[model samples]
Target: MSKTILYARVSTADQTLDHQKAQAEASGFVIDEVVADHGVSGVSTTLRERLEGKRLYDKLRHGDTLVVRWVDRLGRNYQDVTDTIRHFMRQGVVIKTVVNGMTFDGATQDPMREAVRDALIAFMAATAQAQAEATKEAQRAGIKAAKHAGGKYRGKKPSFSRNTFQVVKEQLDIGQGASAIAKLTGISRQAVLRIRKDPSLADEALKRWGE
Candidate 1:
């Protein structure tokens, strides 16, 4: 009996991994182990390159079953996703999807069928990559247009509320390290360190205690 591994990737802090896991469980997968990569941008980081994502390359054995919500969860573009899939498939790993019980395995006997499968994988991966590229290009164009037109209405604004900055400071005083403070407050560790670096910043953080 082969082991089953569940991989759930949430690119942004706003996205929840629970939902993906729930979907996999609801579909009858035991989920022996879970590998999650958080705050990792799917566009630049492929399924193999991520911090936890890289673990799959080493952990998955020949008969292990790898599960994901969708192909896009593997990569933002088609090539990244395809390469990741084909590499694992060649290693005798079977990839199972929660979205549609789709399975990709190297056990198929027909060469022509394999070729067709490979081609289809290529097409899908390419399409995913193209879509990511197009989205980036569109953002660039939008930014350029905004630069000429005062750029205010392009996308969502950063939610750097004053309250968040305050929580960051208090957490520091409570003996929370920079990483913990960032994780708890949803701010970056770099930002927390910056505050600790300057006494002036401490003063600012202290002020935030009441508000």
Candidate 2:
């Protein structure tokens, strides 16, 4: 049987994976399994490197269908996203996205259809990469503006414990992915990335709150 599997991700703890699953179900996918990487940043982590993402590789079989909210959930870089999709296609797995109802099937031998499919994949991947870069640049600009205004760049105060902060720092020092840290601590992936990018800012926020 060709099983339908749902792979969902969110960058913030406040976001729920249930909505993604519901979207899939509404799209008529009879999902047999669901793999989620909640509070995981797609900008910094490749799909394969994510905790639940790795499990997808092991779980999906030939003839299976993989469903996602969008192509960005698969990856945020053009090369990474395209490569991942092609890899799955080559393995006889069909990829579907709930948002746009996009489908990528490698089973087709028609040259024209294959070209169109590849082109769509490239476009989506490029768009995802561009969006991620734009978002990062915007964040940098915001931080710079704040610093210029004589405001210390204390990022948002994370709603986690001091121990969670310690674990975040340790994970970052050891080169752990933000998604993994967020998963372990139940904090937003953005929070983990913020600490990874500048622990000092996060520390300042903690101090300000007397944590």
Candidate 3:
């Protein structure tokens, strides 16, 4: 029988595999199994380089469905994401995302459909990579700014942690409401609005406060 497996990557202490699993279930996915990689950097490590990620390649059979929170969970960058998705699609595995409920099926034989699917995959992969790069750049800039300010910087500490901010940002990116993101991340709605307004500033605040 074909199975539906949810893959989660937890890169920080604030991120939990259980939370990801819960998110998947809440998104209406009836997952048969959960596979995860802890403390893995999605931007720095390829999927195959991860221990559990490798298991995904071996355990998943044709006709099985692979579910992720986002396309970023599948690979390290645009190229890696596209390649990994194509590899799985070639094996007849259907890839789905919990965020937008995107479904990519390789079982179709129509040329036009295939072209559209391929284009969508490329766009999503590129978007994921671009977001990752932008976040990294923001972090670096934050660190540099903090170092330059040195002891003179006395910025107010952020009400949210790095992980909480990330969660809020992800939800906001998917068009979630500020109140919803605040409830989900256990922060104030105002804080979520602040982050939504200027994510880079929020990130810099965390870094400046040494969070």
Among these predicted structures, which one has the highest TM-score?
Answer: 2
TM-score preference between candidates 1 and 3, better one: 1
- CA lDDT, candidate 3, residue 130: 91
Tens digit per residue, CA lDDT, model 2, 48-70: 89999989888888999999989
- What shift in Å separates residue 138 of candidate 1 from its native position after superposition? 2.4
Candidate 2, which segments miss by more than 4 Å at Cα? 157-211
TM-score of each: 0.72, 0.74, 0.71
Q: Comparing candidate 1 with candidate 2, which one achieves the higher TM-score?
A: 2
Candidate order by decreasing TM-score: 2, 1, 3
- Supply candidate 2's per-residue lDDT for 99: 85
Evaluated at residue 173, the lDDT of candidate 2 is 85
TM-score of 3: 0.71
- Please estimate how well model 2 matches the true structure, expressed as its whole-model Cα lDDT: 0.85
Cα miss at 173, model 1 (Å)? Answer: 5.2
How should the candidates be ordered by lDDT, best one leading?
Answer: 2, 3, 1
lDDT of 3 by residue, 94-182 (tens): 99998899999889899999999999999999998898889888877776797797844435578799989888888998999976786
Residue 6, candidate 1: C-alpha displacement in angstroms: 1.5
